[model samples]
Structures are given as structure tokens and as C-alpha cells.
Target: MVVKKNPGKTFEDNLQESIKQSNEKIFFSRIKDTYIPPDLRQKVRVTKNDYDCMMFARSHLFTLELKSTKEDRFSFDESIIKQHQIDKLLEATTYENVISGFIMNFREPTNKVFFVPIKEFIDYQYIAKNQIKDHKYKAKINKSSIPIAICEEIGIEIKGFKKKVNWHYHISDFITEAINTYRSKV
Candidate 1:
């Protein structure tokens, strides 16, 4: 089935449409923040939830944080994915049948997408950090950023077709990979 990309649609919008076309049983929604008026100020407190969207398919719930960057690498130091977001994702993974992760879109020069499970992401962070600390390391590693090569190694590359309007990503592939990974862990 062809999932057409609309001209002004956001990444989440396209993803929702793709999920809809992928499976009849799957449901997707973009989480929106409750608007708080400026007048409330100190009277009302709102905690930010950085999750971009959620999906329910085949009795499994998925919380996804979406990020699109034109750059070749996503920088940890630059806070492309915030600390709170990381905490939320990690927390979600502690539960059963709850798959939480990130969908990173590398745009422009490389129109590629990847679904990185939280555990793998954390492990990669540890490796990156250790590589930074090791002065005798031979391979050139960027201490602050996760380059595309590393993303390909640690994450599942989402396949897609580029149409004249936009890209039609196979989101089902991501769902399958996530479920498989989760099952393997369990």
C-alpha cells in the first residue's frame, strides 16, 4: 500500500499515516501538551513530557520520541534529546509490553531513518563516553555526537521510498523490529 506524503505534513503526521496504512489493528496518536495561560504562572505548574507520539498495535504499547536533523550527527552535548526525555524512555522500558525509544530522521544529504531502542541507546552512550575517556583509542570518535555510522550499527534502519512530494517510511518494519527486540530481552 502506498502512503502518500502531504506537502505541509510534519514527521509525526506522516508517521501516523504510515502506521494507519501498515496495519488495520494499529492505532497512533500525537501527544499534545495542555495549553496553560501565562496568567496562571506560579499558580499552575506543568511538567513537560517530551514524547512525540504513541502507538498501540497487537497488544503492545509504544512510546516514541521523534527527532529530525539536517546534520550528519546528533549531538548529546547539544541536547537534541533532552535529559527528561531520556529518563522517561528509560522508565517506560521497565514495564512489560511497553516499548519506548527514539525515531531519528537524518534529513537533507542522507534521507535516512532509524529506530533506536532505549537500552541500545544507553549502551551506546556508555561506549561513546568510555571512548572519550580513553586517550589511546585509535579510531576517531566524536565524544559529543552520535554519527550516522554508529546509529546504523546500534539502531534498526527504517526503510522508505522517496516520492516526489516526500518520503513514505515503512513504519511497520520499526514495529516488527521493536517487538522482536523486546521479545528477545524477555
Candidate 2:
């Protein structure tokens, strides 16, 4: 008798699970009804003409790329609009579908990194500028290159989500903030 393995989900599934375990909190932004966190969905990806994104959540799909070095930043020589990515996304786009873009830097923790959606990158250049300001390398790109202090560049965005992080948590800080956010939402 001959037998075969399930082959299961291949590799992407493992990658997504790793990301969700480490970074699901970032994707849990309050949308409407009950919380729909990153862990809630299995992301599907469609790649065409050298562009791809993971389909996840309601009206939301995410594409992720990992950059290892600072040089990788601002280094993509591609169209302002990800036409190829969009063409695939177009098929999946729906009343509840929104494309969440991400140029992930795996070298750093996802929470510390900033990912600007493809649309935002096209619609508002300023968003990329603000997001990338996380890197305080001593290089002059332009007037917007406000010389950053060493302490300022230490890092600000949360290094990871609450539920999955393995390190310490400033419980008081989170409690205060959560109360404020939940109150505001109410």
C-alpha cells in the first residue's frame, strides 16, 4: 500500500502563525463588533506580476515583506502604486474588504516597526515619512530630516502585543491607557 502526507499548509501557514503569535495585538484595533484580532483569520495570498498580499480579516488583506538592513529602507524601485498587487486585490476587494499594506522589517520586532499601507503610501507621502522617522540614522535626505536626538531614537512603538509578548509589562501604564481607550470608545 502507498501512503502520502497531508502536505498541510506548506510554509506560509507557519510564517503567518509565527507573526500572529508575536504580533496579533497590533492587528486587534477596534473596528465595530466583537474583537476580530489577527489570530481570527487564515490569511490567503495571491501573487501576480511580482506583487502579492495576504488576505485576512473582513475587508482587509495584508502583504508582508521582511527587510534586514537599513539600506533596504526606501530602496524599492517600483511603481508608486502596486498595480500588480492591486489587480489581485481587486478580485478580493469587497464592501468589507480593505487592503492593509505592510513592508515589514523582520530584523526588528513587528510592534516597533511601522508599516504603511500601499494606498497610504500613494495617497499620502507624509505617512511614510512619519513612519520611517523611527530610524534615526545620521543621514540627510532633506529639510524634513530633523536631526534626531540619540535618546529620541531609542524607539517608541510597542515592541509587541500584550497577549503574546514574553517580557515584562508595565501593568499600570497599560491599565491606564486601556481604561482611557475603552472609555473613549464608549
Candidate 3:
């Protein structure tokens, strides 16, 4: 019998390779440290979408959506923010037991990270009720099961001369950082 390839695993490998190539830090130690039983690693699945790096491990999982733009005005797409995770769960037939996952978007040239809970932040529509500065907003996670559009590049902005002073994101330093961050969190 021919074996089927796992897209999630492929995407995760690509992400790791990209990070490694850049000499930056991307953590995979969480795979080993999972409280889930050893049998579950087999349960874990990885994949990709139009522009996402997906991973699954039991009731919770994550996706690192990759993106790049010409200038500074970049943002995350409001729709299908969790589609990768949702689809993964659907394929595994265990999504009913899972709560939610996270969506981390990386806008290129600006190694800044915007992390949001798939079910909480991504799915919600916030309506601003106030005028000018006092506008109040209410938001909710979209329960409609729509396609996950995780990243968006709205536009860009002009940086000041001081931008030269910002510390560059060295990949090796970032890799160490991702690992250390995960270590402390666990």
C-alpha cells in the first residue's frame, strides 16, 4: 500500500528549515515536552494553507502564518484565521475534543509577532460604539466555521531615521529566543 504524506508535517519542516536557514530560532521542543501520551505524537499532524505553517497535537495546536509586504502597513486577515487548525482537526476527527489554537503571524522585514487565539481573537467582529477617541468596541469569535484568512498586508508606513537604531533580528538569536521562551512557558 502507498503511504499518504502529511502536509502539516511538511509545512512544519519547511518552517523549521526556513528558520534554520536564517540562523533564527524556531522552537519544536514543545513536541517532545507535550503532556499528551507518547502515542499521541502519532496523533499530531502538521500541514499548510495558502500562507500558513500548521501543527496539531491533541486538544490544542498552533499555526505560524508567514507573510511579507512591500511597506509597513501589514495586518492579519480576519477570516479563516484558524482554518488550518480547523481543517487539521476535521481531518483527524477529534476536533470536538479540542478547545482552540493560536495564530502567530510573521510580517516579513519586521520580525514582529502578533499572536491571537484562533477561536477568541480571530473569529470575533468588533463593533466600535463610540465616536472619535472614546469609541467602545465589542468583539466575538466567529463560530460560523468560515475559511481561515490569517494574514493581510494593508499597506506600509514611513519610519523615522531612528529606525536604524533598532536591533536587527538575527536568526540564531531568535531561534534561541523561541526555544528559551517555550522552555520558560512550559
Candidate 4:
């Protein structure tokens, strides 16, 4: 009998390679969703994690969860964060060293990205409780709910959408704005 090792690498390895190469494409290539066999899916444990990308600038950390929708809208559900992830995020937010949040990458009308802090997400969890319908959870956040100070216009055509749409989302201040709003609370 012979034993073989799986060739796939961990997320941290892929992240380091992406940083060393100064290319997000590299990181995404490694972590991007791939087709899985039914047997494989059952054998592996999948996380209901919200974040798609996370990195550190100096001592401060930023965990960015990526999202996209066919329609020109952004929606979030309570299930996006698992119990453990929620616990970790809650603990991280309490300290001055971390900035965890989500980025909605819109691929319709035009390419756009919207940033929402984890705190805002937690708050919405409570606010959205009033939006229950037929025992199902629902919430819709509009442009007004999004702050212009923390968005960006990435002028590139994002592939793999239901329709051909330009990406034009922009967020001006990333770290500074986060520091001002989130850091103060810590």
C-alpha cells in the first residue's frame, strides 16, 4: 500500500504568495471556488465565512469579505457569519489592532465596490430582525446606507456575471476612514 499527500495548499500559504507577488490574482487563483464532487463536498468541512480576503498593514489588520449580485443591489443575511467567526470578529473588533468588514463588488450597470464595517453588520443583524417575512430573513441596503467616504470606482469589466456590466464602484478612504470610525470605539 502507498500513501499520497494532497497537493492543495492552505489559505495562508496562498495569501503569502499573493503578497510576495504583489498580485491579488495570485491569491484569488488559489482560493477561488472550484467544482467539487458530491463525495468530496461531504468529506470536506466548508465554512460559512463572509470574508474573501484579509491582510495587514502595519500592526492593524483588515479582513475583507467580498460579495457580488446580478441586480444592482446589496443584501446580507444572518447566516453569513458562523458562530466561531462571529466570536472571533467580535473579539477582534474590541481591540484597536483589527478592522474587519465586507466589500460588496457589484457587477451590474457598472462596476462598483461598497465597504461596510463589521460593527455595522452586527448592528444590521439587530435592525434586520424587524424585516422577517414568512419566517425568512430579509434586508436591503441602499446607496444612502453606504457611505461615499469608504467606497471606490474600480473601472474594469469583471467577468463571470449573468450579464455584461462595467464595474465602476469606488471607495476613497480605506484605512483612514476605518481608523476614524472603528478605531475610536476601541
Candidate 4 runs further than 4 Å off: 1-35, 46-50, 77-87, 131-172
- TM-score computed on alpha carbons, candidate 4: 0.53
Candidate 3: tens digits of C-alpha lDDT, residues 130-167: 12233222322123321123222111111111134222
Predicted structure 2: clash tally: 3
Query: Candidate 2, residue 16: CA error in Å?
Result: 2.6
By TM-score rank, best first, the candidates go: 1, 4, 2, 3
Worst 10 residues of 1 by lDDT: 132-141
lDDT of 4: 0.46
Best by lDDT: 1
* Ranking of all candidate structures by their lDDT, best first: 1, 4, 3, 2
lDDT of 2 by residue, 145-181 (tens): 2111211232122133334423222322322333333
Stretches off by above 4 angstroms in model 3 are 1-14, 18-53, 56-60, 63-109, 128-186
| lDDT comparing candidate 3 with the true structure | 0.33
Give the winner by TM-score.
Answer: 1
Estimated TM-score per prediction? 0.80, 0.35, 0.30, 0.53
Candidate 1 lDDT, 41-77, residue by residue in tens: 6699888875878888877888889888778778886
In order, the Cα lDDT scores of the candidates are 0.76, 0.33, 0.33, 0.46
Error of 2 at 68 (Å): 4.8
Q: Is candidate 1 or candidate 3 better by lDDT?
A: 1
Cα lDDT over the full model 2: 0.33
